[model samples]
Target: MLLHTFLAPLALASVAGPAQQDHYGWIHLFDGKTLEGWTEKGGPYDGDADWSVENGVILGREAEGARGGLLYTEQLFGDFEFECDVKINAPFDSGIFVRMLPQKRGAQFTLDDRPGGELFGIYSNGYLFHQSGGDAAWRSGEWCHTRVRCVGHPMHLMGWIDGKLVVDYQVPEGMDEAFTPEGRIGIQVHGGMNDPEDAAVRFKNLRARRLPPMAGENFTVDESGMMTLTAVGEASGWQPLFNGVNLDGWVPNGGSGPMTAEAFEAAGYRARNGVIEALHSGTAGEIRTARTNYRNFQLRMDFQLTKLANSGVYLRSVDDGTNPSFNGTEVQILDDFNWEAASGSKLAPYQFTGGLYGAVAPSKSALRPIGEWNTYLITCVGSRMNCALNGTLLWDVDTATLEPKGGPPFAERAKAGFIGMQRHGSAAESESEVGASFRNLFIRELPEMGPSAR
Candidate 1:
């Protein structure tokens, strides 16, 4: 069906699609002349004054001795981006409510009061993300544009006033079931007090779009010719090591200076359909992130290999002119089915997919065959490490206890270094080109240990 077919019944669509849209296209939540998809939080008889549509804007007001209420959308959203233009009359406590449960627990972006555009949470028994600050973007009698985005996995909120980013915050973990994963968006009118004269709020041009699993996690290129890993989960904390477009964040292993577009292609890193492939490079060596020096992080990626292919993932590795296979801790990725026959012996325990190179072995093989994709989630917090492949736990050990392998003492490996991926030369007998393909390379650095972490 066309885009209009899905959105027309709700409201007159303000914007439609260009047909090839990959993300959520725009949809109008308000239909200017009526409140079709909205209902009052309390019944009409419970509120002091009624909310009504007037001159293309939704207006709410209360009398001097009246109690205020909320107008909410019947539809619920989990991760989404919402935008509207609001004009708040003075002496009114008004705000935009998002991800609110039926019991009225969620977060709010304050509109007017002490200051403007402050974020407050109703979860965790009333928490304030940040205090209201600066001048109020809303004029006494004029309209101001406001935008809000909330995402899942690690719940977060980002907001803007008059096109300027004002609030960016991440809800801390451990308050499970308190903040509802799916809830209705609400426009709140304060309950206690009201202005004797101009006690009202008007909202118009209201619209919303869906957000990703995490915020700012997509691999996108801006007009500046630079790459950006939009913040995901937390505020601007997660970044993509390989953005899957150009090699903007990587450098050829053992090579120095800023990596250029030409040098990246010459090094045999090609991106197609969101996957980075190491093809025909003939062990051209591994590629490492130019920023390097990562300490504690959770890294995730998906890999697919051909029969008899071989490669490795290196973490916290050094660049001493030696290969990352020897300088860093490698998570072995080899063709396990044919390795024993090709090498004339059974595959060693440490030579399988999730092994820690030569220092430690994976508990069992978690390979998903040669053609199917397998996911790897590797998390390193200080000296302890945990790895899982294809939904199966592979190895969880303290690197501080392993015997020394080669370069640094295994216990005293450099606290921070480069991240690399090895390209094995070729297979033993077939000599066919050996390479691997990887996608969705997401990484997030963990915060330092603190009381909250405990």
Candidate 2:
């Protein structure tokens, strides 16, 4: 069972106006009376469409025989939050496009006939993500509200329908370089054959707010502009935490036998070439740095999960515990899609990859597809922590706000402890048998912040 909840309308946070003013410095994108600061493109006959402002709404009703294209914002933006209300009749297709380039390179937040709030990455030929399915939030008689947040640096994108948080996505590595971080915002009139005069889409209440840029190489700032944590870079005096060829400075735990390198290796934890890999051995385990106990530090590593595989990186923990996750902290690493579909399995939002297991949920899903390597940068200082998956800020949160499941209270978590990785087993509950691998493990210790810093 996947705990994916959509909030009720009354329970949703404010989407616009002074209620949102202090939280987000919003700027109106649509003046309502005219399509100023916007340009039209693409249609049956090259940028030709029956697009006009009518009754305070931007309407795109195709002319006879005209296929639709886009009405785009002239100004370009990078990291920002956007909101709008849309009304579309049945048998029509439209979308909200961001970072749009000339050849359809960018991302789209869908307004299709299917689930109305899904994200798709567009390229010259097709889309990058093919996921689809969700509740039909649209009605024949009423307008639908949608909200989107696309943040750069650690590029994370999110979407909400009727104020219900739905799509939380992370742009893949290398994929970011394909389109400009700053590009036009577009209202798409999907190109296809349809009854030109009858097919219509209207948009209103368009507004957006810009987010602060990612400031430091070692640290990250949240959307509201708060310093979360830091990842020490090469120039910042960071050192290798894993030496690649051997477990020279580490200890393995969670097994029932001798805790030696050989025992761990036999238990499926192995060092091959320059990578630390956990082959499938049907046993759950972990490995921790032997002599290092870190408080405020940045830990970076590259991880690859086999199809449906599961594992994790532990922070500030002891090796003697049976459940180190509850004892310390575990940044979950697992195949979210497969893990959720496993038989007899139940997963909460806080149990997915990049999540602070059983505590805080990741604001977005940022993992690469299983079988591909993804980079992770985790920084913990005082009560603040941040995780960046593949150069995207997955989430930034203050630990004091998290509610724990079955451990020492979240507020009372350890100040300093060893860094480690969990070696998951094929438990009877899930009966999963996928493998996990890691490499390029590095860490940089920072001076613990005092009371004033907290």
Candidate 3:
């Protein structure tokens, strides 16, 4: 099906798509009439009732101080897509929240696209999140299209001048490290609560939609000639998480396998076609790193899976019985389309792609399709986990579920371990073996959980 087929049922579709609308996982928020599920914060609900409509335009007047904020919505969202129209009154400021609690200093989201759209300040535990390009463009009174895509825990916020994609930002790494994946979303009318003056702003054609798992064909981009794609200060530099070849510093696990570094070359697992392809797709072994075990690092790789194939990249995995889900943790690499049919629909989020096996599940869905390559970036520390497909949030498990719940949650039992890949058995093999392949393996070590591990 087309993108429309995946996003048509979204609640507030603009009647612009197929039979319904091309809205994905979106839940209807504003009914375009009342604020039934809305609330107030920073200032009053209608800090300035002057926000009423003038014919068809939302007009904003002056309010006291700078506390003209609106913290509405009875819901909060994780990795998803949101879009709306905004018209500012000259030097206006606004905010779109995700993973927030809605208060003056409670995880505020900045949508300021104009010059100085957002100011950077340590709110929770992150630094340099609201780094605006260069405070320059801002119209006194004109409708501006706004779109925000939250993927991989970082929100890719962008502003449009009329119809042009101007401002763009990737939320500084670790910005949402403290914010929960679920919370109430709010809209701000920035001002002082005790004094509301000139804090007037109007919002019309305001709408939002949540998207679903798109094909890999929908995400590849060339950033070539895109000068704005450069990173700003304080942002984490791009780390090479994979080398695009056979597992060099990795070793295969289970049954005392003899597949060592030299063995990889003997089997023609090493290559140079821009990516490493495992020649032995019929084998039941894996290549594991002999160097280090990561706890709070990120892993990204592009892969292609077979029709009835099953596999996963195990994180902090150990050799207890060879089942990563029960041994350590597995980021499910199965096709979301057939995974349910092969195993069951009840697989926990942590057991799927970007999940912590049976411990945690991603807060959103961000997987691509077969033959085409998809990206998987998983971050783990202690029992906490976060994974993203491409740039979308697919899994964000917590510590609560990653505990030693005995048979219920096994991965939690191992604190620190090795990272490995798994090849599982299907009906064709009662031995439950894996025949999947992987290339471009890389890793980065983070500071240990405490001084004890250091």
Candidate 4:
């Protein structure tokens, strides 16, 4: 379902203070006195009716089942910063339109009733951008403080509850074109409404600030004005984790039978759609990291699973020049919720989502709702492995033992080598599907382990 389709009025947009202290901050889209540089564009409003303005808010009283009206600023822009304070009753949703080409490019930053409501997807053009944040604290009849920035190619959106950046996303490039040639800023009354239960959106304190285009150089910066100059050059070479189109750098190992890279990649092990995906049915080989090893590092990826699929990540591996799971230890990834993934596997609490694949179970179940992207970050050092799933630490283990009797073993935990991906057999489960989807795969190798922090 489209994000705007759901309505959960957030508490309130921030009153925190100007996002940019200087005069180059936000240019108010709503001038309390009148509709000024704004107008509606949707159902029944017929570009005729006047949207009410009281106490500074531009109220959008929704029409039953209507897509709602679009409020566009009289001005057009390119690279800029947009921020606003919005509030509405329950079931009401709205979005800040930016760089819209109207009939072509759609809203880049969409805010709705759901918590952490900042969505990055084109109108019907679909999504190629994402980074979302917000809490489910949105109830009816409240206001929300939201802010968005599109400078260079990275779109940073912050959804503030009352007065803080509750959700922040630094959108990567490649998903551009949502904003058009200095287009108008308009408000929409999203199509599909019926009765008072549909939704109503009211916005206030709107502003947009134009900024300069960003180059690769703009990527380096913290909260400090302490600017450091440097030259723009190709970054030093590093082993590619994924080809972004195919799994040309990995080999899966483990469980029952033989699984080859050719076999795995042939079954659609791909690096497409901005993510690396592998669909396995009855494979038994581990996918080993192509080059290099790591003593400690933060490895992160997003995935969606099918019931009964079993897999894991092997770290500090010793490549036999072919399969690696036979050498390194493994970190488990399975849809414990699926009876199939859990078949033969004990149905326990921590064992479900982020467990250490049979050795040490998680302290908590951190899996996301099905179909939602769940993130896992693993840090290994010595005999210690700390894992966090979706911002929550689920497993913290020390002095672990690995056994191939069931899966892979780690005799060299304190040592370092390659990383591996696990492939479980299909017949092992009821439905017997041995696969899932993985995307946004990235890793930042940590410094060599020093004295045990444990």
Local accuracy by lDDT, each model: 0.65, 0.66, 0.47, 0.51
At residue 45, give the lDDT of candidate 1.
Answer: 18
Task: Please identify which of the two predictions, 2 or 3, would achieve the higher TM-score against the true structure.
Answer: 2
Query: Would you estimate the TM-scores of all the predictions?
Result: 0.48, 0.50, 0.42, 0.46
Write down the worst ten-residue block by lDDT for model 1: 1-10
Count of backbone clashes for each model?
1, 1, 39, 42
Judging by lDDT against the true structure, name the best candidate.
2
Question: Could you tell me the lDDT of residue 73 within candidate 4?
Answer: 68
Q: Among these predicted structures, which one has the highest TM-score?
A: 2
lDDT of 2 by residue, 21-121 (tens): 22224667777788777788521113555689899999986665656778877666677678899887755667787766575366777666423434333
Candidate 3 ranges with C-alpha deviation above 4 Å: 1-242, 254-262, 265-272, 278-283, 320-322, 341-351, 400-412, 426-442, 448-454
Can you tell me which runs of candidate 4 are displaced by over 4 Å? 1-240, 252-264, 282-284, 319-327, 340-345, 348-350, 400-414, 427-434, 450-454
Identify the runs in model 1 with alpha carbons over 4 angstroms from their true place: 1-236, 258-262, 280-283, 404-408, 427-434, 450-454
Q: Which residue runs does candidate 2 get wrong by more than 4 Å?
A: 1-179, 182-234, 254-261, 282-284, 427-434, 450-454
What lDDT does model 3 reach?
0.47
> How does candidate 4 fare on TM-score?
0.46
- The residue-level lDDT of candidate 1 at 116 comes to 44
Error of 4 at 339 (Å): 2.1
Model 1 residue 185 lDDT score: 82
* Tens-place lDDT digits, model 4, residues 1-454: 0001112212222222222222222455565657766645421222322267777677775554354567776565555556666776655455566555545463445555544443333232444444443444344466666665554433444444555545455545654554333455566555454426535677777776544222124222222111122233113111235555556566543322344546666543545454555555433345556554676665655565655555667777675553343355566676666543233334544346676654666777766433334566676766667877765677666635434333345553327777766555443332323266665455555555622212
